[model samples]
Target chain A: MRLFKRQNNVLPGFGLTLGFTIFYLSVIVLIPLSALVFRTSGLTWGEFVTTVTAPRVLASYKVTFGSAMIAALINSVFGVLVAWVLVRYRFPGRRIVDALVDLPFALPTAVAGITLATIYSPNGWVGRFLEPHGIKVAFTPVGIVLAMTFIGLPFVVRTVQPVIEEIEIELEEAASCLGANRWQTLQLVIFPMLLPSILTGFALSFARAVGEYGSIIFIAGNMPMVSEITPLLIITKLEQFDYRGATAIACVMLLTSFSMLLVINLLQKWSRRYAD
Target chain B: MSAPVTSIPTSNGSKKRTQTEPAAVRWLLISIALVFLTLFLALPLFAVFTQAFEKGLTVHLEALKEPDTLSSIKLTLITAAVTVPLNLFFGVTAAWAIAKFSFPGKNLLITLIDLPFSVSPVISGLIYVLIFGLQGWLGPWLQAHDIRIVFAVPGIILATIFVTFPFVARELIPLMEAQGKEEEEAALVLGASGLQTFFRVTLPNVKWGIIYGVILCNARAMGEFGAVSVVSGHIRGMTNTVPLHVEILYNEYNYTAAFAVASLLAFLALITLAVKTVAEWKVRQQLDNN
Candidate 1:
């Protein structure tokens, strides 16, 4: 490798820039993240299992993962619809609608939390009508789902939108001329091409929702076993000065993040393969 | 032997043969999208403002003028001020290295840069606490030195930086990668120094991408809640940022006050979105020209 290394390049400062990048990355991200692993290592296997698998913590896992799944699924459907409409059709106020897709990303999570809680709290705007029909949103797992869906909305729409735009209309026209109906064209011709990106978007939305905290906590009602999410559970542990327990649970959650990183890598490869 | 399909349009509706779905289908899809967006995106934004003004504009104004609220705003500003520039420097350097170089483990480095995005914000904040809190790795040393990192202004800044670590770099990497090293190579061959070439050629090429990244990074830095909250200790009038302040107010049953402070952030979000839209348009225009 050293023998093959080229030193003939004209560009300079590679050493300075790369050194700074590695040093900064190590100090800011790598070292701190390793602290989680180091701290978790202090626990015995028994202790780790007990901390992560406690009934309350287990419930939070269920709540967090379940609601995030539901939320990601919801975003996958509606986000694709939004992207499809935004790309394929022109309606009034389209630019405004397009810009608004990113509101959840730009809006502070706390503001989203309070606003969502207020709007869905039985006596609030949409909640008032739903309450009459025996539906309660705020202070429930459903509210957690709502918040997650809101935060994850832009991921799917943004990801799928470009892919949708890249889809050639001639393919659809060919399908139609071949006597396949609209639905057949979409299902047979288009959906396969879009699948990889759709999965990527779904995975991204799910990952973001899984890690979400500020927005879900306010709306989640934070009942010990019912609506409490894992992030909130970690906060609860930290508040109680249960540092060991907090990191233990955080270690498990961190595993999820690492796995997400892997999944993202694989998805990128899959999408690249399709692109080629 | 095939029938002439061109004549089929006469039997179909007069809406011209297009690859798109029929008009009725289009209207249905558009309506669904509009309603869904309104319910999820538009109304909550509307709610933040309406709730803020529900107790009259005077109360909303008073909430904004509240001492704690003002202090939180100050802290938020300070945090963003410090965090954005630091991350901006890292972003440019990292992008410069990764985009222009082809060393081994380059892909791994790129992925590592994005590590914070996948991690939970609580964990992002917690990692520092684990290092600097009373029970952490440097806890005794920090306490002895009277240096505070976690649960203070420094902690807040650290967490914001972590959460926003990848934004600028991520924006520039792809952009610079696509722009290729030709321009900088040209500048160098013309006797320009490395720094000179960077400032004159590379920076201009990625200026819009940098702007887009900085705007986003700044917005997240100021608006970050979960990470900042985990590290902030939520000490009102001191460590609490704007989002945390809103949380405290809302939890204390100060709905009007909470939404009032929240309206300001909502405004920030709107401004960020507006800038983002304009930046995106500018970039698109540049692309079209190219």
Candidate 2:
């Protein structure tokens, strides 16, 4: 690489541009997050632990993290199928189906929650059918899963769709020609190739689900220890004027999410290298 | 080509026949997806419309005319107007710098920009309150200056900005990076000043991406609930946004009013979808031409 050669003449001075970028991001993002950590540090160690580990907070952690994991798992399977259908086939209304896969991305989370709650409430159209069968959705843990699944599905689908499109059909055909059965062909050829991208999709969906608040709150019924999510807990603490408590809980969540994401990124890198 | 086989093995023949199975199964798959989406997405939206009409148009209209509902809409639009433009400027400048240069902490800055996307909105709202609330670190200073941030419009706007800031920047980074420095270099070589070349060449190239990001930011800002709710204090007709307004009505057992306002926001989202489609189509056209 020509270290200092001026390209045709574009923007001069790479040093100047890089400085601006660092200063801009530092001021806007890093400072604010660091301030959050600094504020939470005001609490004593015992207070910090108690604030984040209270019975109600523990219940919220279970609901938020547990439902998010389950929802991400469900999305990983179905989102793969949705992406496969969009990429591998040419059908009537294909464009519309492709577009709708992005609906969750475009729809406002609040409106999505409100709509889901309305449709799943006892007398709501779909809920009416389920109620006869004794299945309650809205205001339950089940509804939290549904809301998370609704918003998280697109993350998995969109992430995997491009990788699916890029994969060559010849690999599957080659596997079949080698006397492999359909299941074998999928397992030996396609699945290995897709594993890394699928996991990327899963990680993205999981992260989104864990952080989700608006869409779940409307449908979650928000009963203590049952339907309340971590985000809701943080909000509840804030409303109650528990500033130290809110910051402490938020710090725990931030650290946990960051570590999980770090682990997922490592897994993704290993899988990609393995496939290559 | 090899000579035709004297007799084809049954198993091999069946394998060949199954090659076309995917074509046949494709329709079955499409139908299943269509039904699933209708049940989950379309039906729920339909439920909102039906609930709005259940009390007759007169009541629905009355709900719309309510002062609180109107104020919520106004406040939401004003916040979107303020936040989106500011983010657009910041997004473009940051994206430009990131794409055009490399330095220490480049990757870290990218991750920082995406932090809001990964962090929960609930936490985002709480962070702002923890800073500006009456008991917050800056509370005394803000009070001394006769400025109130928490439970006010400024708090709502700040929360909205935090969550939506990443949208436009995320959209433009990859697009701008891929376009690279060739055209920009050519313009610069021709004596086009830095700002002039950017406006004349670069801006046209990235405008569609910017528009798409703005559309997304606007949609999220208008319908933001968790963050705003945490900070707004739910002051009806004062600090309430539409989503908060709907929640209040729903809490009061006013289902008609709740769904009516929700329907309005849903309609606005539909318009957003339309704008997004146009923006995407424009970008696609540009890509094809290039």
Q: DockQ each candidate and list the results.
A: 0.59, 0.44
Off by over 4 Å in 1: A1-8, B1-15
lDDT of 1 at A89: 76
Which residue pairs does candidate 2 place in steric collision?
A: A10-B185
- Kindly state the number of residue pairs that clash in model 2: 1
Top candidate (TM-score): 1
Per-candidate TM-score, chain A:
0.96, 0.93
Candidate 1 local lDDT, A18-92, one digit each (tens): 999999999999999999999999999999999999999999999999998999999999999999999877777
- Could you give the CAPRI-style class of model 2? acceptable
Tens digits of per-residue lDDT for model 2, B158-258: 88988898999898888888788788888977878888888999999988998999999998898888778878988989999998898898879898998
Residue A110, model 2, lDDT: 74
DockQ versus reference, model 2: 0.44
Model 2, A14-111: lDDT tens per residue?
Answer: 55655665575565556666777999888889989988889999999999989989999988888888887777655667777777777777667777
Score residue B93 of candidate 2 by CA lDDT.
80
Error of 2 at B283 (Å): 2.8
